[model samples]
Target: MNGLDLGVVGNGTIAGLVNSVGNYQWLCLPRFDGEPVFNKLLGGGGQFDIWMDGLVSRSQSYDTNTAILRTRLEAEDGAVMEIIDFAPRFETRGRVFRPASIVRRFHVVSGTPRIRITLTPETDWGDRKLPAVRGVNHIRFNDGELAFRVTTDAPVSYVLSGTSFLLEQDVSFILGADESLTDTVDVITLDWEERTRQYWTKWARSLAVPYEWQEAAIRAAITLKLCVFEETGGIVAALTTSIPEHEGSERNWDYRFCWIRDAYFTVTALNRLSAMGTLEHYMRWVRNIVAQSKGGHIQPVYGIGLESDLTEEYATHLPGFRHTGPVRRGNQAAEHIQHDVYGQVVLGVSQSFFDSRLISRPGIAEFRQLEPVGERAFAVHDTPDAGIWEFRTIAEVHTSSAIMCWAACDRLSKIAAHLGLPDRATYWSERAAIIHKTILEKAWNPKVGAFTASFGGDTLDASVLLMAEIGFVPASDERYVATVDAIDSTLREGNHVYRYKTEDDFGRPKTAFTACTFWHIDALYRVGRVEESREMFESVLSSRNHVGLLSEDFDPSTGDLWGNFPQTYCMVGIINSAALLSKPWSEVI
Candidate 1:
C-alpha cells in the first residue's frame, strides 16, 4: 500500500519518491512543477516498479546526511538485492550539475535474483499513456512534445516487455532527457553517485544544527533544500498535490507552487540553521515578485517560474491519493484577497538589509522598493479578507493578518535604523505603533480570556500564538501568556494542535495542522513551561513517518500522515523546534 513512509531523492532541479520496495511512486520531470511522469502515488496507472519474485522482507533508508536512498529486498530462496536511488547532483566545471534525472542501481548481494522491471509513464495527469519506442540499449517514452528515455545496461527487450530476468550482476538505469549518454552506464553512474554523496556530506557539514535531535534536524534541512527550485529559487510547499488533509474530506489542493506565507517560514527556519544560500536564492525570487507587482498588489502564491495566473482546476481523470477523488491541479488561493502577503513580502526580504555576510546587501534603493509593501500592510491591517487559513466564505479582520502587517512595519523600522535613516525609521515606527495599539484594543477578547482569531471575535485560534513568535507581544507579557494557555486548553489534542474548531467551507478540520502543533510547542517553551514543552515535542516527533518526514496534517488518534507529502511547513517546524529545544553545544561538548 502507498504511504508517506516513502523516501525522497532529488537534485534541486527534479525529485522522485520511492516506496520501501523501490518503486518510483511519484516523480515530476523537466522541473518541480512539471508533468507527473510517475503518478502512481495519486492512484494513477504510471509508475516505475522493480518486483522481486517471491519477496519476503524489505527495508528502506537514506544514506547518512544525504538524500540518497537505499532499499534492501530479500526473497524466500535467500536471494538478496539492494537498490540505490538518487538524483545526480554535484559541482563540476565551476558550476553545480543538478540535472533533471533519476539514477537507479540494482546490485545483487547473494544469489541469482529474478527481477521484473515495469516502466510506465502517463501524461496529462495520468489520462494518457505515452507510447514506447525501443532502441538498441534504451527505450524512449514520448507523448506529444514531451519525451524522455531510459538508458540502461539491462536488456532492452526484457525492459520493454516487463519480463522477469535473472540479475547475475549489477545494472544501472538512467531515467532522464532524450539525449544519449556520453560515457558508459557503469562509469557515469558510479562517478555521479560518489560525487553526489560527497556534495551532500559537505553541504551537511556546514549546517549549524542544534546539539540535540541532530539527525532529525539534518534530515529536515536536506528535505527543505530539495523543495527549492534551483533555477528560480522558489520553494514549493510540498512535492505532491491534492493529497487531502484527511481521508474523504475533499480538502485536497495543489501545493506545488510557492506560497508567500509558507516561503517566509521556510526561509526563517533555514536562516536559523545558518543555511544562507537558500535564503539568498529565495530573496532574489521575492525581489522579482515585488518588481513584477510594481509597488501594487501581490498574490499569495505564484508558479516557481513566476507565472501569475494559477487558475484552479481539477484533473478529473486521476483519482486522488488513496483513491480519494478530486485531484486538483492549480490553486484557487492565487485569486484570494490574502492581505497578509504584503507583510510576508517585506519580512521575507528584511534579513538581506541587515546581514553583512551576504555578498549583495540591500541598500537605500532596495528599502525604497519595500516601503510601498509596508504602506500596503499598514493600509490593510484592519481590513477584511482571507486569513492565514484561507477561508472561502467567511471574511474577517484576522488577528494573524493584522499582526503580520504589524511585523512588516516593525521590521521596516529596524531596517531603516540599520541603514542610518533616522527619519524613515521614525516614520515606520509610528505606523507600527498605531497598528500594534489597534490589535491590542480590538483583537483581544476579554470574554474568551484570550486573543481570538479575528478582531472583535470570541473564537480561539492557534495562529494567535504568533504574537510571541513574531515579536508582536513579549513572552513575558501577561496577555501573551494567557493567550497561550487558552489555546493550549482549547485547540490541543494529545500532542497535536488544530488550527481552529470553527467550521469552514469544508466543514471542521479532522486532523492537526502539523506546523501549528510546533507553534504551540514553541509557545509553551517561551512561557517557561520547558518540561511540558519537551514532553510534547517528543510526542509529536514520534509521529513522524519512518524516515523522519512529515506531511501537512496528522491524525493523533490513528497517527497517520495526511495532506501533501514532505510539506515544507511541517519540515520548517522540525528545524525550528529542534533549534529552540536543543541544549547548547557548550553544555554537551
Candidate 2:
C-alpha cells in the first residue's frame, strides 16, 4: 500500500495528515468523518502541498508536547527552510479558538531559497478538482455548498503557476472558512502558534506520566486525544482510513468511526494517566449510546455524529491505497452482533462514578439505564455471534466476548452498590456469578490445557490473554497462567503476537497485531514476569516509526508498520504498558 509516513495535526473539528516533505496527503473538511478535500492518500486526487523547490534533505517532528508539526528542508545548495504547520487551537476570550482552519508558517533560516505552493483541493472525495478564484492576498475554492479559502502573504501568481520565488521574508498561510483576514498574516499566525503550543504543553503537564519512556507515552496520549471529536465527545479509531493491515490482504478498513471496543481501551489508558477530560466527555457519549440501544443491542461502531446506518460501499472511482482496488467507505461490521460492545460500553462508563475529576459523576439514573445492558449480557453470555474479529461467514461462541459480558455484569454489581441499591447489587452479582461459572466450565479445553477461543473449540486466540486484564481470572490462577502459555506457544512469532492463526474470512493473517503484542506485555507484567516484560516492551517500543507513532499492525519479519495511521488501540497499548511496567515515581526524583 502507499506509505503513510505523515504526522497528524487536529483541532477536534478538523484534522490533516502532513507527509514528510510537507504535503497534506489526507484531510477531511469540517470534521474527522467529513468527505475528504485532499484525497492524495488514496491516490490520483488533489492535494495541498508546500515545500522548497530545491529540497534535498528533510526532517520533521511535532513540537514537544504538542501536535504542531515542524519540517525542516535543506536544499543541495546549502539553503535551509522550515515549515510550521498546525490547526489553530487555544483559549481566547474565555472560549476555545478551535476554528476549522490550518495555519502554516514558512521560514527562511539560511541562504536564499525558493518555495512552491500547491493548494489544489478536490471536491466530493476527488470526483473533480475544483478551480480557485484568486484575489490580491487570498484565494477561494468552492464546491457550491461549501467554500475553502486560503489567505497568505505569498504572491498568488507564484502559487498558481508553481513558480519558485526567492524567500526573502517569512510567509504565513491560513486555510479556513471563506472570510477575509483583516489582520496581518504574521501577527495572527504567530499569536495562534504560541497559544497552541502553550495549550498543549500545559495539557501534557497535567498527565501523571511514568518516568521511563515518558516521551513515547506522552506522544501516544496526545495522538489519542487528537482523535477525539470534542463537539460530540466521540473518539475515532484512527485518523486515516483504508490503509490495509497486510499487503493485498483486503483487510483495509475505515477507522474514522467510534467503536466501543476501541474506545474502552483508550479511556482505560487515559484514566491511568489522570487525563479525565477525555474520559468525562466519552462517558457522556457512552451514556447516550447505551440509552439508544434497543433492548441492549449496541452496534460495534458508530459515526462520529452518531449516525447508525453505516452501510459499507466501495468508492471505485478512485484507486485504493497503493492501487489496491475496492477502497471502501462505511463499515459492514456495524451490522454484525459483536457482543463484546455491551461489556465495553459498561467498562467505559463505570469510571465516571469513581473519578472525582469528572465534571459529572453517573448516579441512579445512569445505573438504571445500564440495567438493559447487563440483561443482554446475561442473556447472550453463552450464545454465538460474530466475535471481536468480526468473522463474516463463521459464527461461534467466542470465549473473549463472553468474558466481556461477565465483566459487564460484574461491574454493574459494584456500580449498583455504589449507588446504595442493595437489592439491585445482589441481582447483578448473581448473574455475574453464573457467567463466571459458565465461562470456566464451557470455554476451557482439557486437552489444549487452557481456555480456547470459543466454547468447546480447540482454536487459540490471543484475545484470551485479556482474561487477566479484565479480571475474568486472576494472573496467579493456574487457569489464566496456562492460557497465557497456550497463546504464547501457538500465536506468538518472536516477540509479536497475532490475533489468531486459524484461517478465517480472508485467509491466515501474516503480520502481528501491534495491540495484541502490548496485551502480552501487560499480561507478563501482571503475572510478575518483570524481566521478560521489560525486554518485550523495549522491543515493541522500537517498532514505532521515526516519529514515535504506531499503526494497527506490523510485519515482524521486516519490522515495517502496516495498517491505519496513529491507531487508537496500538497507541493505548503504549501508554498502558508504560504505566504498568515503569518503576516507582519515587525513584525518578
Candidate 3:
C-alpha cells in the first residue's frame, strides 16, 4: 500500500491521493497545509471510497498526459466499473477553475456492477467524524471551520446508507466547498476533464526530456509539480507526513512544510527538463523568504506562505500509519539553523539572472538583495548548525553545509560577472576560494582517506558524495574518489544508501534514503563507473512502486517504500538520474 500504487491529482490549490482500487486515502483540504479530509493513509481515519463490495480484480492507470486516475474494478459476478478521479482544474475564462474539489465519475463498463460509496470525512486529525446534513441535491458535512459539500446525481439516500446498488449509466460526484452546482455534473466534469488533459499534455510536450527513460522522468516530473503550493510558490518535501522513514521508528515528522534545501533540489531537477514555470515561481518564493529573514538568518524549513515560527506538535488522537502513534504536525526543524540553505537559495536564484528563457530575468536589484545571503553564507560556513539531516539534538559544522557555502559564493561570482560587476565578482570569487580551502583543511581526514561528515570529525556520511556534484571537488580528484569509496564502504547496504549511521534523535536510521541511493548512482557515474552506475540506477528504478513513484525512505531488504508519499526529493532523484544516464536525443531518431 505504498505510494507507488496510488495516484495524485492536484489543481495547484488542493490535491488528493487515490489508491489503485479507487479510495481517496490522503488529502489536505483548501490548501496543502490544511487539516486532512481523507487521512486513511495515516491509520484509523476516514476515506472516500467508491469500491466494489466483493471485488475480484482491479486495474489502475492515469489518463493520457494528465493526472486523472482511472481504476477498473471487477466484481465476482463479472460486473466491471471504471472509476475516474480527478481534482477539477482547468482554465475558466481568465482564471484557473481550481476550486477545492475532488470530482469522481463512475461509468459502468460491463454487466450491472454493485458499487458501495463511502464519503465519511473526519476532521481534527480523525479525532471525530463530522455531522452531515442531507440536502435536496447535495450532502453537506459541517466540521466547524471546514465545511464541505458533496454534489452528485447518485441517490442521496443510497450514499448516506452505504447501500450497494446496480450501476446503469454514468454518475458524477463533486466533493468541494459548500456551493451550489449551477451546471449538470456530467457536462461540467466532461469539460473539466478534457481541458485538464489538454493542460497536462501541453505541459508534458513542453518539457526538454532526454530520449531515454522519458516516461519515468515525466512521471517524476508530474509528481514533483504536484508537490508545489502554487499560491505561495512553495514546494513541500512530500504530500503527507508521519509515514515513518522506518516503520514504527517514532521518526515521523510533518514534511508538508517547505524545506529550502529540498525545494532547491526540486527546482534544479525541473530546470533540467526546461520546466521554467516552477523554477520561476520558486525563485520568487525564495527571494521573498530571504527578504523576510533578519540579516539573512534563514531557517532550513518554512511554511508554504513564508510563515516562520512553525511549532512542532503531535496529534496523539490519530494513529499513525500501520498503527504507529503520535503523528506530528508543524516541523520543529523550522527553528534549526541549517546554514546550508543560504547556499541553496543563492544557487536556486542565480540561474534565473543568467538564463534567457525566464520571463522575469533578475537584474542588479536582485543581485544586490542576494549579496546579504552570500554574506550570511560566508559568516556561517564555519559555524555549528543542524546539518542537512536535521538532527534534533546535534549541531556541528557539517561538511555538506560548508561546501554549500562555498558553492553560494562560487555561484555569486558567476552571477556578478554576468551582471558586469567585476569588483563584486572578484570579491565573491575570493570568498569562495577561501571557503573552499578552509573546507579541505578542516573537513578532510587523512587517516580515514575521506572527507568526514563534520569538520575535523572522523564519521563518514553519504552527504560527502555531493562533493563532485556541487563542484567542490572534481569527480576524478583523488580526495573525491576516496570520499566516494569510503562512503560506499560505510553507507552502502547492497545497492541502497543510508544518509548516515550515526545516532540521532531517534537513533541511527534503519532504512535507506532513496535519494541517497540516486546520489550514490550519480557519483558512481561521475567517477566513471558507468556500468556499475547504470546497473545501480536500474536497481533503484525497479524499487519504485507500480506507478513509477517513490517515497522518502525504503527498507532495502524488503524493498518497501516508507516515509512520506511521492516525496519531491525522491522524485527529483528519478528525473535527475534518468537524464544523467540517458542516451542523447541525437540517438532518438
Candidate 4:
C-alpha cells in the first residue's frame, strides 16, 4: 500500500488495469503530472476510488509488445466496454519522446452496464480531493476547488453512486469529447479496441533488435518509452508515487522526476535498436539545462516537463494508503549536486557516438564523433561535485566516479574518430592520462588490491565491479581480478548487492541489484567465464515480473521488488548483458 488510497492492481509493478466499472481507478493522470483521479493505489486514502459502480469482472492485456493497455470491463447487465489507455508513439516528431501521458478509448460491446466514472480530483500530492459539481457538459470541481474537470458532449447524469453515470456501457464513450456530440447523433469520431491493438502491433514491428532476448528487451524498451517526459525531452526514472527502500519504512521517496544519469542509461538501453531519436531529444534537454545559469548549479535532476522548480510538499489533508505516512510528490534529490551523474550522461552519449544508428539524424548523423566527447570531458575534468552515490552526506571524490570519467572520455574519443568527428587526440590522450593518474594516485590502497568508494574510504564497495567492465583495468589485470573476487567474496549477500550498508536496510535488500547482477555477468564474460556469465545473466532475468519488467532493487530474502519500479538502469543492464551473450551463441548455435 502507499500514501494514495484504494486497493492495488497494477501499481506499475507490472502492466496495470482496473477491475470493471470503467474506473480508470489505477491511473495518476492529466499527465502523470496531474493529480490522482482514481489512485485507489498507494493504499487508497488520497482519492475516493472503488469498483462499486456495478457487479462484474474485469481483465486486461498489453497491445502486443507495446505499452498500450486495454482492459475489458464486464457488467452484470451483460454489457462490456473495452477501456484503452495509450500515449501514442511518435515517428513523425523531430525528437523521440513519449511522456507520462495517456490516451483513453472506451467503447461498448454487449449489454448496457450502468457506466459510472467518479471525478474526485486531488491537488498537490493527493492532499485535497476537490468536490465535484457539474455545469453544462463540463463537470468541474470549481466549487471553490478546481484541479481539472470531466468534459463531454453527451448526456451523463448523476446516478445512485453520485458519480457520472452512463445509461449504456458502449464503445460510444469518447475519452475527452462531449457526450452529447459523441452519443446518439455521434458528434465525435473514435476507434475501438481493434484499431488500438493494430497500432501497437505495427510499432512492435518497428524494433530491429531480434536476437536471443529480444522479447524481454522489447518490453523494457516500451517501459522506457512510458518513463519519458513528453513536453520536454527529459525522461523520469519511474512513474509511480511511492515505493519504500524498505516497505513501511520512512525510506519512501518520489521518483517522478528525471535524473540525467537515468535518462542517459535509457538512451544506451535503446542503442542497439537505433533508437537515436530518443537520445537526440534527451540531449536537447541536457544542453538547455547545462547551458542555463540556473540557481541550482546544474543540479542532477529535473522535473519531467523541465519544470525545474519542483518543491517537496507532503499532502496533509489526505489519509495515506494503508496508513503509510509522508506521501510526497517531486524529488528533493534534484537540489543535490551529484558529480557522478555527469559521467553517466557523458558515458551514455559517448556510447551513442559509436552507435551507427545515429548516422540518420541529419546534421547529427553527419555529426563529428570524437572531438565533442573530448570537449565535454574537458568541461568537467577537475570540477568537484556530488559523486555517483548522490550521497546526502558531504561530497567527496569517489573512485567509481573517476573511473567513469576515464571510461567516458576513452569510449567517446574512439567513437568520435570512428564517426568522422574531431579527434582532439592530443587533448583526449593527455586528459585520459591525467584522469588515469588521478584515479590511481588518489583512489587506490595497494594493500587491499580493491578500489575504495572515495579517495581513502576503507569499505569495500559494490561499485568496484566497474573497474574491469569500464576498461579502467584489463579484465586479466591482477588488481581487476582481485577486485571482482573481493566483491564475490564480500559484497554479495547470496545474490544481493548492497550499496554499502545504509539505514534503509531494515535488513539487507533481498535480491542483488539486477543492474549489478548484469555487471557481474559482464565481468564474468570479460574474465573468460562464459558459462558463469550466461548463468549469471539467466539468474537476473529469472527475477523479472510476470511480464518481464524489472525495478531498481529486489529482496533476496523473499524475492520481492524494492527501490523504484520499472527502473531504466536495470533494464539497460539487461540489454547490455543480453547483447553480450548473443555473440557467444552466434559462435556456437
The per-model lDDT (C-alpha) reads 0.91, 0.88, 0.87, 0.59
Candidate 4 regions exceeding 4 Å error are: 1-30, 44-59, 72-83, 88-119, 135-155, 158-196, 293-297, 318-322, 351-385, 415-423, 502-512, 583-589
- Candidate with maximal lDDT: 1
> What tens digits encode model 1's per-residue C-alpha lDDT throughout 433-477?
999999999998888889999999999899889889888989999
lDDT of 4 by residue, 197-301 (tens): 454566566766647887877777777765665456777676665655556655556777778777877877776666566776676676566556231245678
Q: Which candidate should be chosen as best, given TM-score against the real structure?
A: 1
Error of 4 at 133 (Å): 3.8
Tell me, what's the RMSD of every candidate? 1.0, 1.4, 1.3, 5.3
| Whole-structure CA lDDT of model 4 | 0.59
Candidate 1 regions off by >4 Å?
Answer: none
List clashing residue pairs in candidate 2: none
On the 0 to 100 scale, the lDDT of residue 292 in model 3 is 91
lDDT of 2 by residue, 367-454 (tens): 8888899999999989998999899998999999999999999999999888899999999999999999999999999899989999
Per-model TM-score, in order, reads: 0.99, 0.98, 0.98, 0.79
Distance from true location, Cα of 3 in model 3, Å: 7.4
Better of 3 and 4 by lDDT: 3
Ranking by lDDT: 1, 2, 3, 4
